[model samples]
Target: MSTTTALPHWDMTVVYPGLDSSEFAQGLSQVLQHIDELASFFAEKQVQALPAAPVLDDAFVRDFEQVVARYNAMSDEVRTISVYISSFVNTNSQDDLAQAKYSELQRGLTLLAQQATRFTAWIGSLDVEALIERSQVARDHAFPLRKAYKQARHLMSPVEEELASELNVSSGSAWTKLHGNISSQLNVPLKIDGETKSYPMSAIRNMAFSEERDLRRLAYEAELAAWKSNAVPLAAALNSIKNEVNVISRRRQWESPLEASLFDSSIDRETLDAMLSAARASFPDWRRYLRTKARLLGLEKLAWYDLFAPVARESKVWEFAEASNFIIEQFGSYSQRLSDYAARAFRERWIDAEPRPGKRDGAYCASLRADESRILANFKPAFAGMSTLAHELGHGYHNLNMLKRTALQRRHPMTLAETASIFCETIIRHAALGQVEPSEQIAILEASLQGSCQVVVDITSRFLFEQNVFEKRQRRELSVDELNELMLDSQRQTYGAGLDEAMLHPYMWAVKGHYYNTGRSYYNYPYMFGLLFGLGLYARYQQQPEEFKQSYDDLLSSTGMASAAELAQRFGIDIRSESFWRSSLDITRQDIDLFEQLAAQR
Candidate 1:
């Protein structure tokens, strides 16, 4: 087994010098001034009326851009401190200063939220089309900004919104703390190699994906037992937060939580349906792959824990540096610009790769002030780790593209957010598959398809579970058992006859944390949408290599500006059409066929 210390650690000071330096402090002070100015202006003038239209006055345009620039620069400093503090906290949860810094930052964010909401509400009240008639750029951006404020307006009655806004600092967001506390602090007592050791749930739960069946089963049982102990409280946290979302949705006049989320994501109901339908249609293929794995392992049926068991006869070892080079080289072949970006990020220590104590579990890529992107991961030096690097690097690529756009324009909808990362994985996976032998190909394919199954089947189940939980929780509180049943039913619907009935994870309602979000409604479908969308684009790339490059870049570059469907239309892909999504799934089906053929030969 690989030691955890082998994981990477990031050095953020490379982004900017000392935070206490004169220049840094000056920038921070300037941002504070801008925030106060904006807050006071909005608070005083915009009572029920929108701020002056930017299009009608050139002075407003210049001032507004200045306002944005100041905010962006300020945000960069704030993010630097946040990334530094959070990174430290993740690795060393015991660090007092890190915790202090984090708390201080949270308080600061709460203030910013209040200031931002008032400004946005003021903006959303303006007649966007009329305002935009005067300035094309302002007009072009009007719809998205107006839509954002409109969503913000739904939080509460102006009075209740104010109250919730203040209360969130201590109460509503506390739900995440509950989930995180249980997840990060819970220890699962595991017997590994005749030694009984207490492994934190975050660390040992990942072993369920191990190639060794006994280890996988042991880990699964232990994880379930640990979570079961805290199931009631977990259920409560989920119920309370989800109910909060429902109430907020109702007050906003939104019909359903799903509709509210889709509106926030800038995606429509039909596109979501199309994405889900395509995923549902692809399950037979996934089941076929699962059965093939079960047959290889000489088992009668596959359980949830066996879903990620390796298929290749050989286990390839990858060191961190080797994995980095492999990913960069593959990405370089597709686009030199992208390759260069990856090179700079790594060379400059922008990524915190080496895992250590107190570092956060899981992986994420966050934008640093829209000027840079920071990637966090506990890399394991396996095929999955390599793919994770590609996946995260894809996010970096996306951020890089969007950074050049306006501050308001830099924010992409959640639905299209995963495009570059998934696309990058597709590119790397296909390339690696072509070069490797059949046995290696089987391993690679299983890993790839298993990941797809997660976003498709598992995520869909989450979508359904959250939807049902929210609906019921609106009227009443559900006991832990009720939530578990809902989770089990959702899993059954998505997995169908593929997974062993007796082995379904009911405590999933307690485990997966996406439902706990107070803001977004269905944080689930976006994963499936991004996967299929990227694959659809990848399919086009295969058909028209050169032409697809420009088109693909253009699509990613405009993610902040266009609706998800509008972006799709640029490539002649109708995202609302089930046929388009099906085509993407068809590509996955084709990959599964090749996987089965390779597995049988092995």
Candidate 2:
């Protein structure tokens, strides 16, 4: 087997030289000055008449436009600093300076939020329709303005909102940061080749994809032990974050935490229900796939840790360069624009793919601004790692499509956020299936099916777990043992008899970062939405290979501006219908059948 490949470190020169650089200092100063200026403008006597304006006249429009432009400018600068610092921290989570800058940035953002709330409240009090029709600037910002007006109902007084934001920096966000630091510092002890060695959680977790079953099991046990060691503090962090969300959400007059999440997702309850119901109906098929995987591994029942264990004995490893070239080639086969954008990302060093100590776990693509995005991944040479690279590159492709839009218009909801990345992943996976030998085909098929199961099956479990947490958390703080039981119950409900009951992962809440975010509740369902939605789009692309290219780009570009239902309608997809979701699941069903046949032959 090849040793761990040397991964690429992203170039931060585009934002600044470093945290200590003069450029960074100047940028920070400029951002602070901009914030103060905006705050003063909001406090001006002239702005006092904003809410009482009876007519949408030229003067009113001009003043509003100026405020909007300044706000956007301030936001742009803050976002640039936020992205750079966040990228640095993602790769070096233990850096005290980065953490300090992050906290400072949060405070700066709170000040901006105060100004923005006052401004938005004034705008919301206006005749928005007339403003949009009369002013071209308002017309350009119609969607965001309209959304702000709708969301204004939930906004507290500016003072209260500002206080909440500031308090979160020390309370909710502080707890989250503590959780991250603890998780990053953890060392999982595994006995490899008769010698006990300690590995970081991220490194050890990757061993789940190893072909060696013993290694996968050992790593899994060690990871569980590590989590167990920190369970008490992690549980406190989870409870505190969720409780903060509950308090603030109630103060905002949201019907429920889940309702607020749905509003934020730009998806309706009916659509979410339809999609989740479809997923539940498909659990039988998912279980069949799992059972097949267990049989191939010579186990009567698969454990939770065994879920990611490789079924293909002939899995091949791709070097970092090989994976990059392959991803570029696969993207080119679909669209030259996507291919070119990915090539630029590679050439410009926009990706940080190295696996090292102090780096945050998992992969993500951060949109620094409209024209730039930074991708971070812990790249290994295995097929799974290659797929992860493709996934993040897909996110870059989505950002590229939205580059021409305004900053506010480029903010897509979480439901539509996963579309491009998952679509890109499907593209490469199918392409691989066409080229690989039969045994290798099993590896590719297993990898693809395993990914679908995560989105469809595992995400459902997470969604259920979070739902239970919120329901129980409202009554009282849950103990560590109670949280574990809730997690195990959710898994059983979602995974059914597919997994061994004895070996389930109970500390999942401790490891998953998604649950810790107070701002974004119920972050699980979006993966299911993205996968099914992307597959539905991919099915259309397969049907009309040439014509669907533009439609795909159009969909990606519109994601930031339209609702998920509206975007689906452009391609004649009815997301609220169960049939649409089932069609996507049918693709997974076919893959499972193929896997079963291959396993029988083997």
Candidate 3:
């Protein structure tokens, strides 16, 4: 019942009670000395012994693990400091020293990367299997590290690898930084209610969900118009980055940018193919859902802006306390472990849920060292924002599940990472639908359909854009016109017969920051892959609600160790088989049909 105007401030002192703590300074000094020792040892000779192998059972192995443990402890400390500084900058961008420290920390990371790469390459030459075979934790970790070495090793000769690590501080990484500056600096000039106004991309985009159709339409038009002014700069950055990917992929003898991405993700080709096949097959059902949505809004056809437009009688104000309780209770019914995590997340002040000025534009959950997670959000206390909260809590739960994992194995692939978060959102929303009145049910259904379209349609468009752009960049640089053309073409293909073509967004590629990562290519498909995969898992949950909980928890916990296909195999599902994806789409289609029937009955 309370709407607190000010968001609660996080206490970073939980990690380090004071910046000047003797404990921290001593730990830092110890870690730096260890790194110095490692560089000294490796620089002196080729590896005669492996590092950190408990199985080796000699004085050298003991020395190595002790140093590694200390290094890891310091690594965690540095990351925690960087995270706190970055989060502070997100809320207070005007803090020049915070920004400066953030930049310095990133540069420090690049230097650390060179050191780490040299050590890893040295370790790769050793008989790692023998050492790991002696220790269970080491044995469990061998494959993932081996995979990393295999991917990066091919990309450069020993000298080139070392050089690239050093030069990354200035070249490809700099272009990404330039791209971020352009986006963060953009301002949209608009005419609102017969008055001239200026808006940020974040503010104008949020207007697409305004209850007033006139406001939504005006905001959409004004937003698109403003992007025209900065499109050229954004396009150049895209071309430069894509060109960088093409050049590097070829130098490394990679078949394609996508191949590099898949290799890095540790997912096989057949598995990815099956995920795409499932998404394409469900287009008809999604289209049907779109039509139902249009009819409910009394529009002849849906436009891009209208897709997220709030439908009347579907708008509801959900109090934060009630929403939190609802999510906890529903998730508890699914698994007590999940419920306990959610409960603690809220009670422990782990979540920053209130909307405020100077806060970052989106939501994220940052997993801290050893059994802790911090969630940051600009909460509006609406149904949609609550869903975002629940979605992020799902991420917190994943962190909790993987708390015991070593830092190295804990970094799961992006595609598999979405499983728990989306599953939590589904559990909460679907449960709310069952308990709501018919009108409210209609609203809930609308929101669900809207999200499904984003994963399927919007994500497909991004995938197509990246694919074509990479191909074109391989041949030569694409002009702004060419990029715009590709963006529109991709939108038409994915959003076929659903969206008003004239209203399609042609500057989408220019705006989304996902494309700016130099090392990570084809970041688009992961969202679609994650969504459908989670939906497939949700179907299993429905079939045997009691049995699915433990297996689901096990799946999240094992993400650090397994591939997408391997994880699916544990549930008796073959990810490479198209039929498994078909089943997930079938569930989505059923929902679309139900929405249509409900609309018709009304």
Best by TM-score: 2
Query: Per model, how many backbone clashes are there?
Result: 14, 0, 0
lDDT of 3 by residue, 1-602 (tens): 23544545556667655435666455445445645565565555433223443335665465545544544555565556667666666655555666665675665566566656665665565556675665554566776656654754554566776687667667667777666666554566767768987776666777788777888888888777767777777777788888887887887788888988988776878888887877887877787787778888899888888988766454467777777888889998788888888888888877776544444566788886677788887665567777888889999889888877666667688888889888999998888888877777777777778888888878888998999999988788888778889999998888888878888888888778889888788887887777778888888888888788768877888887877778888878887888987887777787787778778866
For model 3, the superposed segments whose C-alpha errors exceed 4 Å read 1-9, 16-75, 134-137, 354-358
Candidate 1: what lDDT?
A: 0.76
**Which of 1 and 3 is ahead in lDDT?**
1
Q: Go through the candidates in order and give each one's C-alpha lDDT.
A: 0.76, 0.86, 0.74
Q: Write the per-residue lDDT of candidate 1 for residues 459-501, one digit (tens) a residue.
A: 9899888888878887899998888799899989988778898
Ranking by TM-score: 2, 1, 3
Q: In terms of lDDT, which candidate is strongest?
A: 2
Q: How good is model 1 by TM-score?
A: 0.93
Residue 441 accuracy (lDDT) in model 2: 94
**By the TM-score metric, which is better: model 2 or model 3?**
2
- Per-residue accuracy of model 2 over 1-602 as CA lDDT, tens digit each: 45456678999887788898898888877787778888898776244224464576787788878877777777777777888899878888888888877877776777887777776677767888999998888888887888877887887766688789879878888898889888887877888899998888998888887777788888888998889989999999999999999888899899889999998898999999999999999999999999999999999999877888888764567888888888889889998888888888888899998888889989999888766889998887767778888889899889888877776777789999999998999988988889889889998899889999999999999999999998888999999999999999999998999999898999999989999898899989999999999999999999998888868887888787778898899889999999999999999999999999999999
